[model samples]
Target: MDRTTDTTALPLIPRAALFGNPRRAGAQISPDGGTIAFLAPRNGVMNLFVAPRGRIDAARPLTDERRRGIPGYAWAHDGRHLLVVKDNDGDENFHLHAVDRETGAMRDLTPHGPIQASIVKLSPRHPGEAVVSHNARDPQWPDLYRIEIATGRSTMIAENPGLAGFDVDEDFALRLAARLEGDGSQTVLRPDGAGGWAPFMRFAPEDAMTSGVLGLFTADGRATLMLSSAGRDTAALFRLDLETGEATMLAEDARADIGEIIVRLHENTPLAYGVNYERNRYVALDPAIQPDLDALDAAGIGDWGIQSRSEDDRFWIVGAASDTAPGVAWLYDRKTRALEKLYDTRPDLADAPLAPMRPVVIAARDGLSLVSYLTLPADGGSAPRPLVLLVHGGPWARDSFGFNPYHQWLANRGYAVLSVNFRASTGFGKAFLNAGDREWGRAMDDDLLDAVDWAIGQGIADPSRIAIMGGSYGGYATLAAMTRNPERYACGVDIVGPSNLETLLATIPPYWEAGRSIFTRALGDPATPEGAALLRERSPVHQAARLARPLLISQGANDPRVKQAESDQMVAALKAKGIAVTYVLFPDEGHGFARPENSIAFNAITEHFLAAHLGGRAEALAAEEIGRSTAQLLEGAEILP
Candidate 1:
């Protein structure tokens, strides 16, 4: 196959390239008001990137030569250092590092290997001090640690003897370590500073659970606990005593499920806080600060990180994002009530014609309602077109209505895309999540089919042409749907999805060893002799013969979580069966594609396969003329291809 040398003439553009290669995706401004950093894939590795204060482009590597490579990054309070974390590979051990921002020097703070260190809070006021949770002392209860950025040493502030989370007081002292009971109601632990921890005060756990703690508020040099809770099962705003533990309800934030609360410190009064609803819009704190934030957003501020407590309380650093705007730095002047768009991550996508996602609902089987977020094509077309069921990675993780890149691409392809939040999805509460615990290939699979049914009933989906695609759990479902109900789906695209359940359960990396406890409850009997047999019953590998449809499977060789052996063994098994199957292995990636080159290559094949099967417009691969050459590479497989 002669590959296309005209990179500019390719039928489809790489989503990763078009998305501007966000290395540390979701980069935000630090509270200290000095530096900026983001997550990005540098040199084919996902690491934290630091852009120093007053200089966005001068950003450098915050972490040193990491062994496993820095998989994730977070800012410390002083903004002088960064906390580089490693977990995506499966071993959840987060070796804490105090990275010197100015010089790019890094040292392991937690030297403790294999111990999962989780950062709960990084002081915006005190740069050196940090609040992190680690299982250093005990495994069941992860005690909180206060670390000094400069010294590279840590002080155990609160031993949560139980399952608890820490919330800092105004003095920046460890005051409230909220202890969660398995049932409900939290025991608020306060420090006696006598080398002991006790309940500084008490509030109804029922209230705390319902209202949802807003935050730890400081005024008049004292601390108060802000509650976004009520007596019921929803979240609202309420204020409580840090010491006395007294409680008072603020304005009933009826929206409940407090999106994210950002508190602004004012003079002995309520600090300006931005309370977001459902990760969508925000309620400008105290009505007075609304205009400030609105003006900032209008000015294209991508990030809003309040720094210091000034008397005017108006000067704040603002970051921004838009349909077309990537992450950017902005300056919001409260005095002038003006916002200045300071920086841009990528200027190329400025006129890319991005669209906001619209939230919609499609009913599932059994009359149960299903929720989804849809992004329509910029170039409008009629209904009854080939659509894609873009299943999210986590079958348990709910898909929110937002601007997802996958959804955007499918929408642009003149297809109505459906993202289903199936049963057992989180955020809907324990019952919903628990509902999916044991129903992996059964009800969970049913939910995917029900979504297709819903789409067809609404005349929004093409009856004869449909594709099922997802990553991780989504990938598993894609194969399962094609295997169990071959006639329903025309093609299946599985990206790092498990083919066999028994292998997936036993083969997960060491970092996920402890996760077996959760896995057992969901899948059943991880250790028992009969357990393997039970998992095989649900595995797509065991049911491969049932699929008479075209299939494409991609696996990352270094995928610690899923492992390459999974795809290798299954694809090999299918080929032996004289079934046609396409298998692509990426040596650089792990559970998912972390590099742009792999993502572009993998997505190109998926696009071509979908177009050929679903009769959508064909797109030629640019970098690799081997896309079809690659598809031709899998021509003789035994399984369906």
Candidate 2:
């Protein structure tokens, strides 16, 4: 358990610079390529802004969103407006809005109260119209509606018949639908030509998440694109013949699923596809775009993605970033083979001593190959520094090699940061994902322990000064690690994580009823006695008495998936045992902290807590920092510096 290190100093990166809103991000080109739009901070809140193409200096804000910033936006096909989606304080009841570029007027396209609405399809054929989905009729199922973007008039095109989701063509025609069965399997259905739906394909429960219809790819409505892992180890891209029921394989990887597909705008024709293992490997499906991909690869600026393209595909807004650098947006001219840098997402980090993330494969005790990323302090000599195990949420999601802010911030604070893609993480093959079924606190926790052993064995971490931190499932993992093996970690941070599986299952949002079976099957069903007992046994709340290290818990008041009760129950149990656990709550937040101020405030408390226990350097919390956020310290304020 060596803790000695050569303390070659590195500048402490400010929490604001690392966690604050980006200078400019989500850049996209207008349909005619006459203007560029991106999300930038307007009065400390991210708002939609647009500028004439190549004239970022002339940018003007189109929307004045003061509270929770706009999450994402896209240019309308008509080129007259921009489409944006917003939710209230991370409640996730998203509402679609259209911003008129000329008048600077924002109109809520779907103003239904407390309903989750999203744009389903926007077509150039119907330039002023968009197909949207909302659960106004029934909270459990969202119905489809065609809406006039300018006037916000709507017409119900199709009603949900207990379908999970629907797919539409560029012509604004609903062609395919997917239904999640009670057994956790998925069935793809097609229109029967007489107002009824006929089953097109069926997938087992294991392939439910990996397999689905992507979109109708054929102009004749006879074929569609799909990603399916049935009869294969990994999910692969395929063109499915709707009439013949045959699938033509397009691209695939043995190690990873097809994660991204680049297609021609409005045409549904795929140009390239990408699969991610340790890093992303993009393959050009159409040879015409090979040169563009080649040029981007040759640029040596990390992984690049085509963010937006002109109508004629002559101009592309490309975003590139790596593990050590913040993202840079570039305007790529396809005709001239030139890449002009637009702006850095975070100019403050351009000169920061950010650590490089190295992807490593660790063997679980059961011999499962766990893909993990490690980032050590830039100038802290290789003498086994204190380590932080940062787990990703989703337990269904994964930790890929990228410019992760948490990694940089923690590394700058003088701790080695490691993120592990343990069992149940997506993007890997189905066998690896299905292997984690109902293994929440048992096998899943073991994989983390094995990763710790590997880090310590490699002289990368001091065995005694390790901490676990994460949100959602990662938060659950942090709590599980602290309680199951209290001797391993020095401290733990849990953000919006569920403590009791039974309560978590019972409190899921009504809109998530479609996928409830998937959760029950993957994490044990609470309705059955045997399953309920298993859930109770695996829940960290049941093992709270075993906790022996410092713990920090943060929660959003309105988390629909993992409700606030989960955190409240765990804190109550710990307090009942006279254990001192720090609790921070954001009344405005839901699943996680969406506001940068709230994030910074929580991290401010977290760093001090870690510093006290793990001997890591921390930036002292400023009074103004917490004043700007809605974070309420409900407990353990004494731990703050």
Candidate 3:
């Protein structure tokens, strides 16, 4: 807990370098292992780039995305084409595009309009085609399709019968489907060979989110792999017999869920699996892959993971990263045992005075243990510093230790940063996750308060100068913190966070209808009187009059989940109460800022705001920073320097 280093002499790290586009990232090796594809800035926007193996200098942009960058991409089994998904301004209605590596031609395979398209399965067994799901036929449920990658022709393979998700096999055949029942339980179904589906397995409401069928384990489809927490607190990997409905445990962790399973290419067999508690631990299941795992562990890299692998399993694109560093991708050759560094994700940060992140477990007021991370200023010397309690979104998602730009950025600006994995966060056992149900602003907010109390008790935070900041669910927590305990925080920042749970549930996207029961069960249902009362009592917008701290709110105008109205309503509530609040809006953004300019611009404003209230050191804003971004200061522009 002692942070006694003199970090005050270090030069300020630029906001752009921390939040801007990376030079190169998300590297994926082609199936044949002859080429590597990654994302790099093209004309200031992130685009897909390709290069021959070991020839990153000769990389060329394959997809020229001018506006919003391509979020993610994958290589087809043939390796002649790449598939990328794009959504408009963060609307989350993703459309699948196929880019020909040979001709640089891009074709929208799912050009059906405004529907969310996701790649279900791609395999070497079906190199010519891919199985995809889209809500084109019905807005509420997505139907499956077999699409030709080369010709862009689509054929309906299966119609969704109100199912939440489908599991397709290596041959692009539907093997199992899961449906969310009205009480928030889940039922897995298998095709009955007569064009109908029969129940394969049923999960209780408590195990709904923690357990489900992963996919078929074998090529014959007689056996499947699943994650089930039905009898245990933590979800475990199991090999289920499709014929007998019997499940045999493959792997389990006492502290965490089996988060990831690494499978062999085309065969769909598990080679290794990972469980993350304080840090990630990978266990090799196949003897043939044990040496490879050992080599990575001995490579002197910090927390490495296999990003991409060739069909033959001889070559792997491994990305190694840590809390203080961005990421470095290495082309690992199994036969040669050679680890060749391909590129640094952010070479600009190589020599920066970055702080170290320490994982700590704090006890909640009610005796629950909260896993948290603390990052102190690199030069902070035996003195309590201003702290920013940074909460993560997903209220369902847990924060893990890694190269977090926000942590580094805040610490560089003379502030201690703390991120807590509160109750209800996944990866922990089901008991911890289910405890968060309907807690939202109640016990969940209590967890954040307890973390702040721990930081103060450890002499790491100046309690009077503390701030609360986050996006989505995190944003909601920020607002709740400032309102519920107005004296606890000096300032708060909310990015795309909902102010009213009732409206948030009402405005959810149509495609999410199948999982409505899950939301209702976790959050209070607005349809029932008691549920409606609970939601109103927990909503932050209703308690705006209690807000005693300076607040900054930002929103992506196109965000489909937490719509602009969420921010608008909060700002309006503050205005009606004669309170001053700064509001920043991006007309072309959704959910979160995808464009780097906007991200840099928002942080530029945020730093100044924090500096004013929390007395933290801040880099002066540049005219070019604001000019380059599409940020519209809807209110309180005078708050910026």
Point out the higher-scoring one by TM-score: 1 or 3. Answer: 3
| Candidate 2 lDDT, 229-312, residue by residue in tens | 999989999989888999999999999999889886656677899999898878999998799889889988789888998888
C-alpha TM-scores of all predictions: 0.76, 0.98, 0.98
Among residues 3 or more apart in sequence or in different chains, the pairs in candidate 3 whose N, CA or C atoms overlap within 3 Å are 6-379, 7-379
Question: Per-residue lDDT of 7-102 in model 3, one digit per residue for the tens?
Answer: 559889999889999999999999999999999999999999999998988998888889988899999998899999999888898999999998
Q: Which candidate is the best by lDDT?
A: 3
Model 3 score (lDDT): 0.91
Q: How accurate is candidate 1 locally (lDDT)?
A: 0.62
Runs in model 3 lying further than 4 Å from the true structure: 1-7
lDDT of 1 by residue, 1-641 (tens): 22211222223434554533553354555655555666555665555677764576677765544323565566665656767755434334566777677777878777775676876765456667777777867654677777777886788876665535666654456655665543334556666678666765444533433333444556553556464443433354556655556676553444334444556553224434433323445555477767765776565443344432222344455545543345565555678886555455555555555545666666666654566665655554445667788888766566764446676666555566778777665444333455676678888889888878877887778778888999999888888888889899888888889888787876775434333455666776756667666687888888877888888888877676677777777787787788888787765567776545566667767777776677664355564533412222344233223
Ten contiguous residues minimizing lDDT sum, candidate 3? 1-10
TM-score of predicted structure 3: 0.98
